[model samples]
Target chain A: MQLKNIFQEGAIAAHFIAESIAKHATKTEIGGHNIFLGQVRADDIDGKKVTAIEYTSHVDMALEKMHEIREAIFAKYPLTCMHVHHSLGVIKAGEICLFVFTSSKHRKAAIDACAECVERIKAELPIWGKEIFEGDGYQWKVNN
Target chain B: MSIEIIFFGQLADKTGCSNVVVDNPGSIDALSMVMKMQYPNLATAKFVIAVNNKIVFDNEPIEENAKLAFMPPFSGG
Candidate 1:
């Protein structure tokens, strides 16, 4: 299962994508798992509160990047399975912003690979998001 | 030649248009043409350009009618 986005619930996404990765490892003797769940934190700008985040991307380009990432991770890590998902549209504060899951025969490798994958995506992907403030205002959050 | 240059997300908002066709380069990279076209002021916007989902950096000889899309830094999960 492959899906990405910052959804309504950060807790739900942590469980969901983790479950997806676990299911793929049932047939293997894999042991540990690694996951990174990105959350939207409350940002105060000039007394304006960020109530939610609206994300967007070049769909075709993003999917292609994911595909390449999947291949890259496989070549770089010893893993039974991996998954990445990011939310699009409005997501409230303390909500799930991004999810990355990886499973391997051991915990160390899995954790390392997951971190690498997440870092690579953040540094290279073509996605964008804007923080929606409390009073009909917003700001784009790029590589920042 | 004449590949379409489409900006998405924040870039589009700044450029005021979703897409445009850049003048064909005799033999150069898409990035050069992109710099020459709209938003030349954004000459240093560190971003990637994709030709139909494939990254294009060098002059690599792309299709004349390719749908090129430029994207700024990704902030997705």
Candidate 2:
């Protein structure tokens, strides 16, 4: 199976997300849709504050893993569509880093599938985030 | 024979470079020994090894021109 590329060069734009939803309007069968957006938080470390997050990933491996997760989620849920996008490079605080959208005929399937996809992406993808502080310092982010 | 090894996240910082080409060390265990010797900081670092993009828990034989990667725990959203 050809792997779907999910990584975007920078933060996900709000207009791009709006366009995605607008395109899905043609699929009238979808009764419900769930969307999840991940934003960079301005976390304080000691006296320094987080200014941005730099994301990196093993591209080939991450795409392969994402494909597996997509297949599994499709098999587990009755969904009409699913889409995911993750930011690469540096994303500033308050910017969108990740976006997950799922649509299904029923609200329950869309809601559950969207949640599962986000959780699996966080745990499985070979991606890392470096939190850049106000001062030239940085720290690796740990998923909680 | 040589293998291509890539490091990710903090492992890359510790290694001073993102990738290296090393002589095939025969087995994953032996490869680890060689890597730790070359990059002593890795001796205390925690990471998982992936041979050709597949994570292997047990020591596995290294093939010629294999692509290996050292990855820390994932923190993607």
Candidate 3:
């Protein structure tokens, strides 16, 4: 399954996506839920203050990559369910930008699956965001 | 000619726009056109183009209507 646009107003919280995912997985007898949320910070870059961010993506590619991540995680981890969400366009500092949630019969499997899914997204996804500094400069961050 | 071009990160900053179409037929290659008009400084920069989100380099054929996304090296967490 895929989520089209995940948000609650200006918020990018993972809980919304997790709730939706839970609703979609009624047959899943999960006992643990592991969630990771990525937030934007006012990072300082070479005297520039990053106040916000501008995001862009190859939408079709990003979706495809996300699907691949889900499939890969399922193959490696015995998870009951998984969900991934990302923010496009501009996300202000203190705003949630990305979320990955995994549920399983055991905590270890949930945690492991969550980690792997997020890692794959960072490595293969074609989404990009530019951190808007306080000054006239910006920086791009990926999961390094 | 129909060409799909995508932008990302700093290159998007330089381009002041996201993806765009060329529209008219041209002899210049897609990458060359992007390099020439979009981010000329990238002429020597390390980067890659994702044809339908798969990264490939050197003589990657540009189909009539394939979605192409361009990116520079990335650093994140």
Candidate 4:
């Protein structure tokens, strides 16, 4: 079976998030929803300002790892649904690079699951970002 | 005994190429030695080795046509 791919080519659109939330309306069992958006930050380094971030990943490994994470979160939380989308290629500062949404019968489960999912995605996914500076320089971004 | 080694993230930058096919060097330690010799710049880089998508630490014997991946610290969200 094919695993669900969470990658998008560029910046995630706001309407995509809206549509995702809208789609969950029919699922009456879910009483609470939590969302997390990761925006590309224009960080200044050594007098250079970051203008964008170009993301890349090992597709096969990332999907496999994501599947494992998805299963684990379901096993641990009473979540009704979970969705993750991360952007590849260049995403300008102030644009959304990641969107994580979780739904549950209670507020706490969705809230906690969303948080944990974000943390794990940052720490575990086999993805990298190249920070493009405003002028001509670039550097690999490291998560803190 | 051909083993494919794939490089990811900063390790790819250090290696200049993403993937290399090498003669199987018997064990993980031997493969590391061979890789360091072939790509001297990789000697100073920090990375973890994964065999067939699973991270491995022990000097396990590698079978023919195994896929190896060298990954640097993950920085994705």
Candidate 5:
């Protein structure tokens, strides 16, 4: 399986997601597929609402870490395939920023692997996000 | 010995520049000390140090010409 770079310049579009799913239809052994999408929320901070999120990363390190995460997940789970994508530039509120797709021969492995992939990506990746408020003010996002 | 320092995320903004070269080559702690003095705002900022793309603790010794990255807490989803 070839691992993609995973970083897109903007939001991950619906057509891209559809095409990803379409690619897997030929694999007859796969019984289940699970997906996780992370959308930019319009959070209200200090009476101001967030307009968008500008993402940046230590690109080389992030890709390296993601590759490690993928390898670990594949080793631990009985999965047929997995894909991860994240947006790098400004993504407006309500747009998708992150996507994780996992397929397995059984439902449990697909579901469990997809969730674990999302959690690991959030904790292990070297990506940063700035919340751009409506009036041009911004704050750094901290993941809880 | 000189080392290359790269800052990411909010730390880069606080430092006002993304990359710099420092003459002091020692442990990560020593580099932090120099950075704190040069960029006072970084003194209060929270971050982690990575040597050659791998995260390392403050006590980790930095080799000459090493590529060090200062990264803030990750917020990616």
Candidate 6:
């Protein structure tokens, strides 16, 4: 099966999350679902508060890497389904930038798979974010 | 051989453009040498090379018209 494109243009909305959960109601085999949402934090950098993050990516490479991560996760865990979404454009502070959802027959698999997916995506994908400060200056965000 | 080099993130900003076609320096390390000379900022920038969408290590030979990307450390969620 082909992998889905995880990039979205704007912040992921709460309604979208609810819709995603509703779509899986028919899958009776799934007993538990775990989610990980990455929200943009308003960080004070050098006394300048960050207002938003403008995200960019090497789309072709990111998709290829994400596909590999998905395959590896599926091979390691007994998951019913998995979905990953990330914002590509500007996302304001306190906005949701990433959404990872995993479902499984048991809670452990779902929770573990969701956490693993978030970690792998953060490490492996070719996505970058420029932290936009309140005064219009920007800096490249580095993951800690 | 001529190859297309795509830069992302801060590398693109430093280079002032996102993509360019450059004379293939034959090997990945050779390409790095040429790029460092062309874009001085790259000399100290930490990045990885991907040839045809797969990350490659040192000494990987570049094929004719291959797509190569210089990518900085990822900061995705």
DockQ of every predicted complex: 0.65, 0.93, 0.43, 0.86, 0.90, 0.93
State residue A35's C-alpha deviation in candidate 2, in Å.
0.4
Best candidate per lDDT, number? 2
Per-candidate alpha-carbon RMSD to the true structure: 3.8, 0.8, 3.8, 1.0, 1.6, 1.0
Models 1 onward score TM values of 0.80, 0.98, 0.78, 0.97, 0.96, 0.97
Candidate 1 lDDT, A1-144, residue by residue in tens: 473432332233556765676577555777888888888888899899989888777776677777778788899888888777777777789978788878889998889999988888787777777888997878888565
DockQ of 5: 0.90
Runs of candidate 3 with Cα error greater than 4 angstroms are A1-10, A14-28, B15-17, B20-39, B74-77
Model 6: CAPRI class: high
lDDT of 4 by residue, A50-110 (tens): 9999999888889999999999999999999999999999999999999999999999999
Better of 3 and 4 by TM-score: 4
> On residues B1-77, what C-alpha lDDT tens digit does candidate 1 reach at each position?
46677887777776778887666653445455555465764566666667677876676766677777767767766
Q: Worst lDDT window (10 residues) for model 1 chain A?
A: A3-12
Compose the digit string of candidate 3's lDDT tens values, residues A1-144. 563442222447556765666684575577888888888888776777788877666667667666777778899999887766777777888888778778889899999888877777777776666777775766676556
Candidate 3 DockQ category? acceptable
CA lDDT for candidate 3? 0.69
Instruction: Estimate, for each residue in B2-76, the C-alpha lDDT of model 3 and write its tens digit.
Output: 776777776666666766776633323556665556567657655677776787756656777776766866532
- Compared with the true structure, what per-residue lDDT tens digits does model 2 show for residues B1-77? 88899999999999999999988989999999999999999999989999887888999898887889999999997
> Comparing 3 and 6 by lDDT, which wins?
6
Q: Is candidate 3 or candidate 4 better by lDDT?
A: 4
What lDDT does the true structure give each of the candidates?
A: 0.73, 0.95, 0.69, 0.93, 0.92, 0.93
The segments of candidate 2 whose C-alpha lies over 4 angstroms from its true place after superposition are: none
Sorted by TM-score (best first), the order is 2, 6, 4, 5, 1, 3
DockQ-based ranking:
6, 2, 5, 4, 1, 3
Per-residue CA lDDT of model 2 for A33-80, tens digit only, reads 999999999999898899999999998999998999999999999999
- State residue A91's C-alpha deviation in candidate 1, in Å: 1.4
Candidate 5, pairs of clashing residues: none
User: What is the lDDT, from 0 to 100, of the residue A81 in candidate 5?
Assistant: 96
Candidate 4, residues B2-58, lDDT tens digits: the string is: 889999888888889999998899999999999999999899988889888888879
